[model samples]
Target: MLKFVKGYMESIEGVATYPMISLLIFFVFFVILFWWVFTATKEHIKEVSELPLKED
Candidate 1:
């Protein structure tokens, strides 16, 4: 099964770049998220984190 799937994938043109593009997108998304987490205000983080426990 693995060999058949690998052979089918190898036959497709430009299929190799798909993984690289996916990896690049995955990496960039995390980097942006990391930056956002670090730059966000502590007060805002605390407020948002308590939302679930807060009673309306």
Candidate 2:
């Protein structure tokens, strides 16, 4: 299995550059995704909370 993966990777043209590009793309995607989640969480926190109301 290891040999197969190694052979497959080696067969690709410009194999060295492929990993670098993949890493960069993943990093950018993760950053954007985290930023989006952070903004959404902040918006959620600002909204009202659900709790039982007590009668005076």
Candidate 3:
């Protein structure tokens, strides 16, 4: 297990792609958040649409 950890650490140290990995993570998070917001908004619109219309 220690050897595996050491190898993994060495592999991480050899890479200069931290920014790319971080950007990918951020993009994935943003997509999930946007999807959640879209569904919530759609539900709210449907609920509002079903409300009893006030007869002026």
Q: Which predicted model would earn the best TM-score?
A: 1
**Clash counts for the predictions, in order:** 0, 0, 0
Model 2 has an lDDT value of: 0.80
The collision pairs in model 2 are none
lDDT of 2 by residue, 1-56 (tens): 99999999999989999789999999999999998877786546555232235334
How much lDDT does candidate 1 score? 0.98
The per-residue C-alpha lDDT of model 2 at residue 54 equals 31
Model-by-model lDDT, in order?
0.98, 0.80, 0.82
* TM per prediction: 0.92, 0.49, 0.45
Q: Which runs of model 1 end up more than 4 angstroms from their true locations?
A: none
Clashing residue pairs in candidate 1 are none
26 Cα displacement, candidate 1 (Å) = 0.6
Model 3: residues with Cα > 4 Å off, grouped in runs: 1-13, 41-56
Runs in model 2 deviating more than 4 A are: 1-13, 41-56
Candidate 1, 2-54: lDDT as tens digits? 99999999999999899999999999999999999999999999999999999
Q: Is candidate 2 or candidate 3 better by TM-score?
A: 2
